[model samples]
Target: MASDPVTLNEFLTERLGAGGVVDDPNDLLRYITDWAGDHRGKPLLVARPRTTEEVAEIVAHCHCHGIPMVAQGGHTGLVGGAQPDAERPELVISLERLSRIREIDPLNFTISVDAGCVLQSVKDAAMEHDCDFPLSLGAQGSCQIGGNVSTNAGGLNVLRHGMMRQLVLGLEVVLPDGRVWNAMHALHKDNRGYDIKQLFIGAEGTLGIVTGAVLKLTPRAQATRTALVAVPDVAAALALYGQARRSCCDLLSAFELIPRACLELAFEAAPDLPDPFDTVYPVYVLLEVAASGSVDLDAMIEHLFEHGTTAGMVLDGVLAGSDAQAERLWQIRERMVEGQQLRGEHLRTDIALPISSLGDFFHTASRAMAARSPETMVIAYGHIGDGNLHFNLLPPADLDLAAKKTLLHDLEAALFSLVDDYHGSISAEHGIGRVKQTSFLNGLDATERELFEGIKALFDPDELMAAGRILPRTR
Candidate 1:
């Protein structure tokens, strides 16, 4: 192999085709920035590898050259985890070309796929086999399976199906030094010591580049009932959730909390978005109950509405009569994110608290925000079933850019403080990328920090893979 710097592109093109090594700056634009446009970097080139062997070769070459590398999936990361570092020139290895459904075992209830396979494609394939991949998210159309596994993403179905961590049965990873670690098994019960695949599941591509995965699948739901219910407050929402848990048990798939501000914003962003209720409410719960077999899902949903209304927890609600209606109802929750984006810049935080302490945290956090900046809009909404809240803060319209910046900083300080007081996680689903590194490090204890550093050293001894992503950059 030639080690000359001038032949770097030649070497890459030799391992992969000429189309694989993207050295042109025009084509590099897409790989340099994240979906959020929050972070951007300048990389020497982008390597699109089709096979795990090609990925290993690229990583190994970069490792030998002392050049850091960033492994990117669909580039849908919120925390800039997929973005390369701007200060240092890094090699970005994109897995988009490796999109392929390797195998689907109906008997094993597993789907083996290349990390670059689009999430929605995997879901569609599962449905074809009379199964379901329950990890549904807003970016399902574009986000890749590898990125989902790397972040251990939590979506609407987390309450029933668990996060990506639970769904992933095995992984195939390219280690820092270009060695491949293949643990792509579909077994459910493995009592082997130290589940090696677990290390790379949520490591944010820091430990290694995820090449493929074997994900667990669930039986397809025959009947799904969707409803948008108005609640008096967060407490009422929690009460409704308790009733839902009692009535449906594991059959309840989704229970999202939607505050009035968030809904109003969504309406403003998308005027075509229909309003389900006649009157406005302080809070809302978008709940879905789904199950397979001959179970009467409608009866279960009706019973929940009855109990909720009887207990004065439900103010007003609308239930979908058809699959199309259910999809339309779901659009309200999905479009809420777009609404926030239309409202301009806002500080987004993914925090989780104990399910029981959610109401108290909301009230306490609201009061604290009021004290800090009464004009700041607190558009908090999230997967209430799993206790994760996207506590977003939108600055006042009157504030200038500088003022908005300060307000966001202050708002983050106040909100994260409240999260700490409640002993909640700083990041609920989004991994600690470059954006939250300081906060993540601040919240870490000395012992945990030492352990994290040790693990990073154990895998990425030279820190050439995804430097400054999850763990701080040593060099």
Candidate 2:
């Protein structure tokens, strides 16, 4: 077992101040549940540490007492990795108070910030310096850098800039044993023996608690263009995406594939938003291009539209004539999550396969889901430039919530099975926090599973850091 809850709470209050510990049931409820509202578990106490030293001290004390700790950042995680179980007598080390942007080196093109700093704040800081942070997501306003680093988050701009791992230059982490590993160097080339920072990038807080990070920045775009194109099907979408990639090359910032059902949901949920194209097609692609040097972005986009029209791949295309119009067009893509909520419960999957299998994967998975649960609505959308797709399944709008859940589970299983058949990863950009832990295990072989467990054991011998997350439990 573990230490007594009363004793642990007392110790936390004594070591840190009374303000650092929260034991009230009502206040602890928010920390217990995940963003998806799917996983729920009450924690014994919540610890809000404001400094790196405070985090280290708390983790050191917990390590000495053999108490499990779950590091929470933003709590916007889809996985239950942040969920703390009161029965298990775990402590939640919330990094909310550690929010701070330490420094911004315009000459070096880097920014050092505390892990609790929100993603949007970093982006704003980069903008002030006439640079860009590149890492972005739907939850940028709420999600913290620590969680992004832990998950190695990838977003729409990943096709051009890359994922969180590529942007991160250095990190400060508190290991499971409570030892502080400070490698906050912003150097481009270190030639170190073993890149220690890579170990915790996507480890999901199982190995350590990320306290801060040094992030790389890029030049801000001088001109940009966005478009909403109506394609006949996924085949046409892929072809258009290829042509745009060849024409725009590195300038092609994002290429998103949105199914007709998703667009309809957006229109239904958010009535204020207007659809750009007059005629609706079966599939639509939201594409964007940004460049630093002055280029005829309008003419380039016009050429793309004309080529797509002549090839019969694009039925109709609408280019953003103004910056406000560009933002409005982008809003349609950004509101995908909000629109998804208008439907019934959603069992979402983020998977990545080979680019060639993108069309086949969607067709096979959607067909399998429809056959498994005929009433479920399949809303498909995501970054098509890369192979990642957000395959979301919603229960029937007419059915009761309970009945819908029963059907949703069956549909999820069918979808995961098809993804496995295609050799696709179950959890792509989203880390296997708690929601997808079981599915990750189901998709992996015995040897691969063993390797993951071995790696976990090597980093966290006692497994006190975010237990039952990323790794499946052996009962």
Candidate 3:
């Protein structure tokens, strides 16, 4: 029941005027596809709304016409959640023009911003006000604040700070039926009612469109230290992490576990990068400690490494002497991704387990990967402090695209089957977008599925908002 071609033209002309609607095919192409160039779709039209009223108007019009709509922000998501449907007549509503930082309260320790404000810009704004925004990610330069909230993103600082969920104090959302919900309380204590803002935080636009948010800010980190460590195995890495926590006390900020194979790939990708240690160990850890007080953080970090070496937990290590050296060490970690992209046709899994189960799960998952196929090489690296691992499988040199495609099912099943035994989630930071929807649904129990369905129906009865991305739609 989408509006007819003539009706659509008339609606745009009357409601949005000239600059609001984009009709050029080339411009349309940018909104249709994802940033990764993997998934592409065709949108009936792309609407750029400059204000909240404009968004509500578009949503209400689409609802009246019985047309589906997909809300997009930044479009840097790895999962195909932002991509609209090509077969159906769906409207793609881009919030890019709504970029604005409305308020930054220093005393309240909050910053309220429009959905389209880029993540790095928010951080810069907070820093300018002599505060800090702790939610940091590699895509912080381009990813929007709305997308970060939608995914409830977890990054390197989650050990000290929390995920995007914990940072958001309140949200201003436009519901599926075009009714607005303004919950921008920006208060630390609001216990009178249910936490309604929680629903829209990680819903990924299935229920409503997040137009604005109030995020908590923190005092800027004063003293900082980083180190590249070598551990015997996952068990040693866990032990070292515990020691690091006790040594650094409240200052331990990041503890990442990196496999030896992943390091080799980084070296291969970046020849200028020098190895931190003379002896190559099976595992390495990139650990950091930051303090807001006047603590000698570098000395404390060095002491932690020395004690680790004495306890036989660390084989070798190097503490970053200067800020430039620390940045270089991080560059190696960032370049590991490019190293991965150079190797084609990889199966990447973003997963989490209980902190206690990490060691056992890591060993078991490695054995499982080996049993499934010797051709697939395992490269594991992630924020071990929070029990999340990016366990990636590299395809064999001889396997072609068609053959790799055939093994995709077994590969995914073999990995996810471990989740059942370890009481872990199939996805940790990444939401169940179009790419993971089928597997996600299959892994859920009857009660969980029913609950999720009820929530979806209650908010979006017609399921017109980003239909088939997180949940399937009925004809």
Output the number of the TM-score-best candidate: 1
lDDT of 1 by residue, 1-475 (tens): 3334347778788888899988887889899988866678988678899999999988888888787789998898899988778988777899999999999998889999999999999999999999999999999999999999999999999999999989999899999999999999999999899988888888999999999999999999888899999999999999999889989967999999999888888788778988888898999999998888888887888888888999999988899989898988888888889888876778988999999999999989988998989898888899989999998999998888889988898789878878999999889999899888888898999999999999999999999888898778978
Models ranked on TM-score: 1, 3, 2
lDDT string for model 2 (208-322, tens) is 9999999999888888898999999998999998899888756999999998888777778778899887776899999999988888888888889889899988898888889
Clashing pairs in 1: none
Off by over 4 Å in 1: 1-6
lDDT tens digits by residue: candidate 3, 346-391? 7777899997889999889889988888778888889889999888
- Candidate 3, run of 10 with poorest lDDT: 1-10
- Count residue pairs with overlapping backbones in model 1: 0
Name the regions of candidate 3 deviating beyond 4 angstroms.
1-6
Give the TM-score of each candidate. 0.98, 0.96, 0.96
Model 2 Cα RMSD, Å?
A: 1.8
Error of 2 at 71 (Å): 0.5
Candidate 1 vs 3: which has more lDDT: 1
lDDT of 3 at 337: 75
The model with the greatest lDDT is 1
